[model samples]
Target: MTTLNALHQLDLDHHIHPFTNLAGHQSRGPLLIDHGDGPFVVDAQDNRYFECVSGLWSAGLGFSEHRLADVAYAQMKRLPYYHSFTHKAHSPGIELAAKLVELTPETLNHVFYTNSGSEAVDTAVKMVWYVNNALGRRGKKTFLARRLGYHGSTVASGSLTGLARVHDDFDLPAIPVRHLTTPNYGKEARPNETEVEFTTRLGQEMQELISHEGAGTIAAFIGEPVMGAGGVLPPPVGYWTMVQRICKEHDILLVLDEVITGFGRMGRMFGLEYYGITPDILVLSKQLTSSYQSLGAVIVSDELHDVLVRQSAQHGSFGHGFTNTGHPVATAVALETLRIIETEDLVANAEARGAQLRAGLTLLEDHAAVLSSRGAGFLGAVELVPDGPAGAAGLKAFEIAHKHGLILRAVGDALVFCPPLISSEAQIDQMLAALRLVLDDCA
Candidate 1:
């Protein structure tokens, strides 16, 4: 049998990673994850650690979900794979689409599948351009995103992402997209500024940008209800309402990138429902199948779908899709995942556990290294005071947590925690205990 060191050498020799420093990895090697158990993962040497970030914030059902495995197996045996393109379809695709439509806001009635969140973002962007071209509004080509908002890391979607790191060496923002202010009240809100006042300021800035750019030149505005990878920053009170109103006034499409916030992560079926805003386009992934399989969907409104249909009639084909657009196995797993979430009442559990997490973290706000505790549902983050450099403090906290057998993500100076939705109060307390220890060590 091949030894673990030999395997590690093989990985270091041949494997390329994303968003990673290759040189650093070559020297230290990768942290080899062998397997998982519920909300925890085991390293190659059998070191078990709590999975606080839920496997990149996608595993809402956690690890070792037999139902998801069973569903995938059943679908593979029944009808391994099929394409939604060229008029060919499968039951899994049809049923998953219908279920998504039923769960989303009434405005979104059509579903377009992709292989990942990045692809979903590209699909949404393409749809906007396609619909505008079909409607003879070619000038409406630019997009308005927000700084620190993470969409995805594809050509077009990466362009839509407003984070500098994503664009720095990539020559990104490749498309005509402008970034606005993120709706983070903790750091961005002016001193003594009321929530309503902060919202108004943001709204005014958006309207001014639209007027300056000429609304006809803008196609859509994309944002996450809560900025995830950029930092788990929830919107200021009434922020979405004001932004939605502005989009309507200018006829710019509102695209909600719920890749992280969707699938009950925010204690709601969809973040739009929580905020009471109906977007023109919705991008979903991550927990869609609890990351058991790579899948994503772009839900569009009837009005936009009609335009695409008419365009197809005129142009003979829509000319957009992937071979695995609606893979049977992926959709099957997603369906079963949704069933589990609903039947297990994980949404309600997320609400309860999220409250507990926020409260526990709030108690640490007075710690010397802590700055703020912010979250919604099971998604939360702690901004730490910078010690040596920008990411120094957050990195220290992460290392300390890992030493205690807990997993957390350090994004810049923020330590983000997103546990499984099904986590019990006891598990919540255990996580809190780990966090408390990290807090003291960092202090």
Candidate 2:
């Protein structure tokens, strides 16, 4: 990207954007961002907009976090790149791994690095299979996932993802996996059903799925602690408790994909703490480095780690990894990012500001188009009364928000909001005001 013209031209000629309507992109072009400060992003023409969704729900420290930038710069100058394979190690990788083990849940003392959430999940899948195989339960190769859960786009991780768009025309679930009903009580619950009943019903469905596939064949159950791309849907009451019990009963490993809810986004160090559920594998990314660097980690429990070691020793190597796995510069940035999150007490801030954000969304419930609000911690969404096709209203609101100097993404008919954890009460109010303007403009 030499200049604005050259960048746009290059995008037009070569860059195919992800999750975008290709035909629409041809005409609409790109919303080129010039720079950012705190939780706000400025467009090329100096149009300032609150980054409501935090750049795909990744940039928790917003765009201009100097500490992360400085660390990355210094690391690059010293030792830019190194691999964790073949017994080779770097200080950044070693120190960051220890720090992660200290921060993550107990028993999950092992860290495996990947470049993205998808790869981390892919690694997790392989780990599950390997563990079962090591124990001579080769038939336990199937995975359990939730419908509408967003995991990632890689072959293995995409298979775990239950979104229709991800599987559309892609012939996915290419792996051995079973998807249960989405635990979206607001949308999926029977009329007059209690939240507890809805949760029990979902639990039954899981049991039925496991039964149909045979318990010995189901290796793992994967889900987001609070579903992210499925329209900011939080778990129903008793959902996690029921899910964990069933997984333990069946000897199946539980995996939590906390790509969006990790770090301080959930107002806790990790989502497991919020839900009081322990996972055998914790998939982390996004806010891990606050998206300052593309670093991901799959934290494994001690029990599973022992199996991995025995199996790998038998095979002479794990035979799975990436070239950029635990890249020094990325690890350095992630270390600093975690340090800042601790010292600044961003998790507490998220809890406080998240209350404000949720209240703001509830106030918007009085809007003609808004049906209701849903969220926890720093994540929230407003379900709109669809005008025509599903999600059309959300897309409209998303576009109209720009006119009010706000940038938020719409998930289906649910307009989602996930501001940086560093956002203040004033910024939250400003975001709400802009969103109210968008809703009014829609009317």
Judged by lDDT, which candidate is best?
Answer: 2
For all predictions, the C-alpha RMSD in Å is 1.0, 1.0
Tens-digit per-residue lDDT, 217-241, candidate 2: 9999999999999889999999999
- Which TM-score value belongs to model 1? 0.98
Tens-place lDDT digits, model 1, residues 309-379: 99989989999999899899999999999999999999888888889988988887888878888888678
lDDT of each: 0.91, 0.92
**Candidate 1 regions with alpha-carbon error over 4 angstroms:** none
Q: Which residue pairs in candidate 1 collide?
A: none
Cα deviation of 291 in candidate 2 (Å)? Answer: 0.7
| Model 1 lDDT, full chain set | 0.91
